[model samples]
Target: MSTATLNVRTGPGLSYPVLTQVHRNQTFSIVESKKDWYRISTDKGEGWVADWLVTRESTGSLNETGQQGTVSTNGLRLRKGPGTSEPVVTILNKGDIVSISETSGSWLSVQSGNAGGWVHKDYIDLGAHSSASASPSKNKEAKQGVITAGTLNVRKSPSLNSPVAGAVHRGNPVSITGSVTGWYEIQFGKSKAWISDNYVELSSTPVEVPATSSEFTGKITVNSLNVRSEPSLNGNIAGKVSKGEKYPILSERNNWFEIKLKSGKSGWIAGWFVQKTVAGEQKKSTSSTQPAGEKVTILHNGTNIRSSADVQSNVVKRADSGETFSVTGKQGNWYEIKLKDGSTAYVAGWIVSIRTGSGSESSPSRNTSGGIRNKVITIDPGHGGRDSGTIGTRGTLEKLLTMKTAQLLADKLKSAGAEVIITRKNDEYVSLPSRVSLSHYYDSDAFISIHFDSIYDSSVAGHTTYYYRNYQKDLAYDVHESLADRLPSRDRGVRTGDYHVIRENKQAAILLELGFLSNPAEEANVTSHHYQDLAATAIYHGLNDYFSN
Candidate 1:
């Protein structure tokens, strides 16, 4: 199949019901063709699939010495050698034909038009003219294993001294043909390759279990708990939850609890740090309504109290860390509280841990001195190394400007008692995914990506803050307002952008475009040390405002 998993329908049309799903690298026999769909014979039964979703194998005969094959996957890399470690020569799109010159374990040396390179055999379909029969091989009776490592290296030989031929990511299914010492021989592509046994889990059969709702209610007990993408610790960090945050348990695997996110996605958290609340206890806690005007302490710093119970309502003020307030009432996921001036407000219940108390003191003043203490923030300096980003008329590089600004901002955040992480400390190229991954891995409270804009029109010299999701919109506006007020440029205002780093980031992320590089005056101002300091100070204050309110 062309896709990772495609739904097989009972009929070729869109109105048909789905019979089953087929995974990538799986093969099926085509029995009939419709206007834009194909009826295939699968192990389950006959099913119809959209023609665009599958790559039909060619029935043309192949020569004994040199066979013809077609690329079966989109963006298939053709490398200089028969291994993933080799440099990529070109990329072949699906349906592109090539001449197979030779084959090495799981990899095929092929010439596509004038370009020749090695491609993984799994992404190619040899024509029927090949001498090899369509029937299963005698060695098909083998064990199955799933790669558990983030990236397991495949070596040319079983020894560690051998060159790395390829790599497989976590959750990849591999057929284990043989075992040698601490290595497992697997059918990688067109040939067999050896992978370290330590990273592969041998299984009798593949298992696909859907996440289901459970009766468990999980509460985080630690100061902060890391949520991951998979059940294993080696899995990438996805997000984090504070000590008092609660989530509904969706499933459990080993020592991890699969929990549902506010976005409706699933994430895994360490089970050891999560305490299961008994159903009876939960019921008892919510059974009796508390008296109006009861007091509750806000455990977290910078908790925003809105005019209404909804998050989108106007923010009345922010409660400082350890501040106390009177609970007027309760709304869905919100606590209605009485402000210092006897005004009513609402704060998110999840962000603040509440404890029963008597109304004694007025709301404390916002802690401006060190509200960010112990908070984690990630800074990403855009475009480095060979990527110079935008160049100004005076030859000022965007990469250098971003780095200088980011370093200054990091210093300011650190001085404010916040823990700061710079995605790139030097002039090294950091991929967008890596930048986002670093933020998640650190469980940062906020992520900022710095960059300078360049356009054909030099007149567009201003600062703009971009955010992707609704949760990040407040942060974007907070930071942008500070910069707009302090900077010596026009305000481009806050906007929704589709930038990769911010779009894919799990934390509150915002991308700041300081100024336009194409404008000489703006470039000169942004490239100066004084302006960099001002920018950094503005961002520092912006973070304070963000957290405080």
Candidate 2:
């Protein structure tokens, strides 16, 4: 079932031609699958569909498919979905023959006699046969490319070494999926071939606007927000604005807001610091967009409103002694404030006297400051919806913890002027491939996957950062150092691992194992609010250093 209106392509990857269109709630039986796409028996006939747009369910045991596999493990359980947490539909024994349908990371959708579900690919032996299925729907936006070569061979896959099935001449038109680096899809039957676009003329021309999108109006949440020329941190600074200012959201790409600037220009702002007001409900909304909580009092006239939780951050404006501002959020020893012009700035916690709604006054001691500005960062909160992730000794759920961490990290990053994109905003299962695809689509400056680790041994506890490619090791080391410093757990250091999210990602990616949920004492400490804030602050500083260096 498609969760939203979806596109059915001729082959697995985005480079393929669109066969037809399907709307939400439209059901299609699985004919076969390759990679992250499924060959579904739709009403229009069998076409490839990206698995991310549809929800999977066990529809009884399926028949044989193109690719076949043998169960390697004895008594391997077949769950309804890819993850281990998904309910088991049935079980299989060693050497049991199963038809491989689709794949989601390390898991494969398979079928056998009276049994249909997902099993770990590690427990399945799929021979040397190359499954002719490949999916590319994660990059659903429209694109077109013109062939440059007078004669070019279209290979069966993205690789140049793959066998050529056909050819296309100059002046032939092709749909660009941007799924592969050098290849443009001009798909054929079972042997879907791709053409090289090394010198081809390409343009990003969107064919359709997703039906699920709605009108949005955004109110500035930060003190002074940086508007970028493009929907990324790398985009040149086009303009600036202050808090409380409202603008019609011209467009939204990923989590960046494209708004009409005051100078009769258009620019994109990080959506993290913008209060979204959907069309219609704008009038009944509250005036405050910041999370209303503690209020701070200025002791001396000419006090400064620094841009971030740092003393060195440029003074945006001056404040008179005894002036008060709501403490929207706290970062170590800094109090985040929204100025009259709607500029967000940080006042040192040690200097300002804090007053909460309950009338209690206090001063903070801890001071923290490193912030990375003008960078596009993607935060992936691992596991969601049906995937609960690792369950800790104290019943600490890794999914919820990662979400909390990602939120705090995003807030701090936004305050520091970086555009932040989150893979999962709520409790929803996002496939591993989709997460990496988003990073690629956004051309993110950095990608961080947040997760809490676990093991059978309850006594071991620590925070470890994992990287795949050598290019990402520096990021892992930088982030892990800060996490190990701020977190109240052991320092496991940085190491290379084969995690799918980081391994498959083309961008600078790293995965953080913030702490061990298997350890009882560590779980209690890691679940605390203070620890999470410190962790976020530390990571923020780490990125600051990484980008600066």
Candidate 3:
């Protein structure tokens, strides 16, 4: 089977009782095939599994050592130990090739570059030793290409619906094997993986660098940024630098800033975390003074006003479109605004337009007929295909639950007069970037990603809502509070999270952790139609409440 553990059921559908779980790479004899389920003969007994959960591989066997496995799931965690309780050492992207050394139950001991750790065996595709190896001639003939996207996703297959295998940052060199419809099959490590052709550029020559002066200075903008031996995130960590630390800029690449270390050696830091400075200028303050009492209009609806200028700072209030605020001060990229209560707060400067005339125009009024009338909402069902997400004690799949909940939520939103767009309607894989792209593509007013949580300690169960940007905090809290009030579970409270989809989305985005599937009671409750309907209704009301305010 392709999954870490495939549930063995008594019948061919979800209605059947689960018998046991079969581990990944396990061989089985097919007895029969139903619509979307398969009846197979295992060593224990005859059991049924979902057809989409496993890949049909030719009859073969592999040796324990020296076997090669390709990562088939996006952002799969590599743990220090073999279980979920263990701390995550790093993340393996889809399309990453790993050398399999040993197998422990449903986990594999794999070596990807200099790191070695245990990953769920189900997310890996094991190949025979012969096919896994490449000849010297083939290696020499492989064409090279440079990644163009800030962070390009490597998939297990060519389709956008395929499971993510790994990721490559901009300027990273990759060996291209061939091309499909709109994707490039690349040779990553010892195995083959695919990436969208739109993000890769064919190159016969090396990356060109601009000539730079002898001395340039840079300052760290973020706290505790890691310095690496190479530009890539997978590179070895050389050291760390705290915020406000200044260093001599030695060179620059796509997203990496190479700086001269105190030891006279060179180290690379993420370009996003470093602010370049002039040869002799001092570090600039994050805040500045603006004309007092100058009014500005909020261009976007639901703009957040935080206690400070930083995105990680606490959000104090939300300003709606066309709402006017008095400018009190200014931060690096934020405008300190005076609220109606005479309190000062900061908003991102990019989302507001300064008003030169009298601030007499009132904010836009909401439709009383429906909470989200004419508003576009994008609903994202979390993992799918090969990414089963967290499996429950009773064999309930988080992916299946998320899809069901997303569909229910879409129906509720549509009934409330909102235009709903689902990232995926069925059991298919969609990358985090693709989901964010869909929100922007549809010009959605709000984006909500549906997911379930899992933990080693099953007793720790709750419902949570997460937002990345400060502007999304209200949406997160509104929906979270509504859902928490309706559900018979512990409230985990709203918090800031750094998820790729929410962090990169152009529109307001939030991720809802419905409940913990690891907990027996919560899993049963969350998977029921009654609970799903309650959640859908709560979200609908929350959207209405947020838009009304």
* Local accuracy of candidate 1 as per-residue lDDT tens digits, 422-451: 999989898889999999999989999999
What is residue 174's positional error in candidate 2, in angstroms? Answer: 68
Residue lDDT tens for model 2, 68-122: 6777776577787878898655457676666676566787877564246789888
* lDDT tens digits by residue: candidate 3, 246-310: 88787777558899888888899987566553333232211112333457776545666789754
Runs off by more than 4 Å, candidate 1: 1-366
List the candidates' TM-scores in order. 0.35, 0.38, 0.35
Clashes of 2: 10
Off by over 4 Å in 2: 1-331, 335-371
The number of clashing residue pairs in each candidate reads 6, 10, 8
Question: Clashing pairs in model 1?
Answer: 61-129, 62-129, 105-191, 106-189, 106-190, 106-191
Clashing pairs in 3: 4-122, 93-165, 93-166, 94-164, 94-165, 94-166, 95-165, 95-166
Using TM-score as the measure, the top candidate is: 2
Give the C-alpha miss distance for residue 42 in model 1, angstroms.
Answer: 95
Question: Looking at candidate 1, what is the lDDT of residue 36?
Answer: 60
Q: Candidate 1 has what TM-score?
A: 0.35
- The residue ranges of model 3 lying beyond 4 angstroms of the native Cα positions read 1-369
lDDT (CA) for every model shown?
Answer: 0.71, 0.69, 0.70
